[model samples]
Target: METSDNATAAEETTPEPERTGIAAQDWATASAVPQYRAAVVDLLGALAYGELAAFERLADDAKLAPSLEDKAELAKMASAEFHHFERLRDRLAQIDAEPTAAMEPFAKALDDFHHQTAPSDWLEGLVKAYVGDSIASDFYREVANHLDSDTRSLVLSVLDDTGHGNFAVEKVRAAIEADPRVGGRLALWARRLMGEALSQAQRVVAERDALSTMLVGGVDGVAAGFDLAAVGEMFTRITKAHTKRMAALGLAA
Candidate 1:
């Protein structure tokens, strides 16, 4: 996986998606295709619903930010999540599928993931959005290569435009460094968030392997087979990114 450190990459990626409204039937598929049972479908539903809630909740939380600068940036990011959620929901519909109901089975476990790991402060919120969303975007970007073209395009589109979330990365790190005391508290909070995330993921497997099986399909190795490790690695990178943010802020990692 190649990583770019330049802001130009950020600039190149964030073209405003022209807001042509979703097609009349974009939210529902026409033919009753069998692909509905695939782990892929279930995963999409889980991801779709999560994005819907994340967008709303994050938008609300942005109000908690101290400055209009932070508030505006975070709100933009939250709105983008809503765009992504709708794109996914519309794509699900085009498959002639039930978006919310398909998403229902995995809802509780996924909701539990967010509820248990909710952030407590402004910097933490930025880290959660920057680190968390970017990691998920990367992993989904990778997984998209395995899917059919339309689904792949839909996934790629949703993952495409993260307008300088890396900027937030730089800002948060600077904030933490400017005040060394926040380092331990935010770092500890980051770990707690990751732990709750992992625990909820395991519970998903223990209780809802149907969705789990649908998520990974037949990836390859035992560790990769129906395991949450891929998602965990995403979270691991989130922590690594958080470390970079902290260090940039002049705080100890």
Candidate 2:
């Protein structure tokens, strides 16, 4: 999982912040706009449900672990994911939004994504947890740039690594080295995850009008907006990060 200095630099560099046109504002200022409030609720709801789902998936995947040590590691990560879900749920309630109602709209889409991409073995499960979760985290971090400062901090906090990244990289690279053919299978699996993950994201945005509008048109006068071209660039950045992650796992992207 060694990252070259060049790769680290590239990872650190992002498109200019000015392009987002979003000025930093607190939740009080940003949420005063009804549309913005609704958008924030929807965003939090989707995130809350995603974290909950991650907790469940990690716990279930732990059963497929080849050793007790691996099982324990995943259990710890699962607990962390649940805590993240709790934070998002509490945040929604604190804002006077009903957590269940906010999350309901996202349930089917997220559930379908998991059902479709269920991993077949321990290594595949590890790849799913690492690759799938990282993609979602990257997308959220990009969107966080447009959010009010308070919400942005909460979003970023919940997206923290939870120590799974290095664990997955170590185990997956070792598995590949022990049997090089595993690399081909995992590389393909990672690609499938990339495609499904991106599609699920697009589906969510298309179905959620307030959230989509928030991204495309900006919320109220407080936030700047993303043009269609900017959205394209966002996905490009996500794709590049995915490639780097694949490389870290000793797989071809």
Each prediction's whole-model lDDT (CA): 0.57, 0.83
The best candidate by TM-score is 2
Please write out the lDDT profile of model 1 over residues 1-253, one tens digit for every residue.
0122431233246463332211111223311223323445675786797688678667877777888987887678778788888887887787666898868877887677667667777777765655455444544554544444456567766765556466555776677668868778766665565555545545654564544443444322121345567556644654565455444434444
TM-score of structure candidate 2: 0.91
Candidate 2 Cα outliers beyond 4 Å, as residue runs: 1-11, 15-23, 222-226
lDDT of 2 by residue, 1-253 (tens): 1122222323477554653333377888878788778888999999999999999999999999999999999999999999999999999999999999999999998899999999999999989888888888877777777788799889978987788888888999899989999999999999999999999998887777667767664765645543567777778888898888888889899
Indicate the worst ten consecutive residues by lDDT in candidate 1: 18-27
Q: Estimated TM-score per prediction?
A: 0.70, 0.91
Residue 226 lDDT in candidate 1: 55
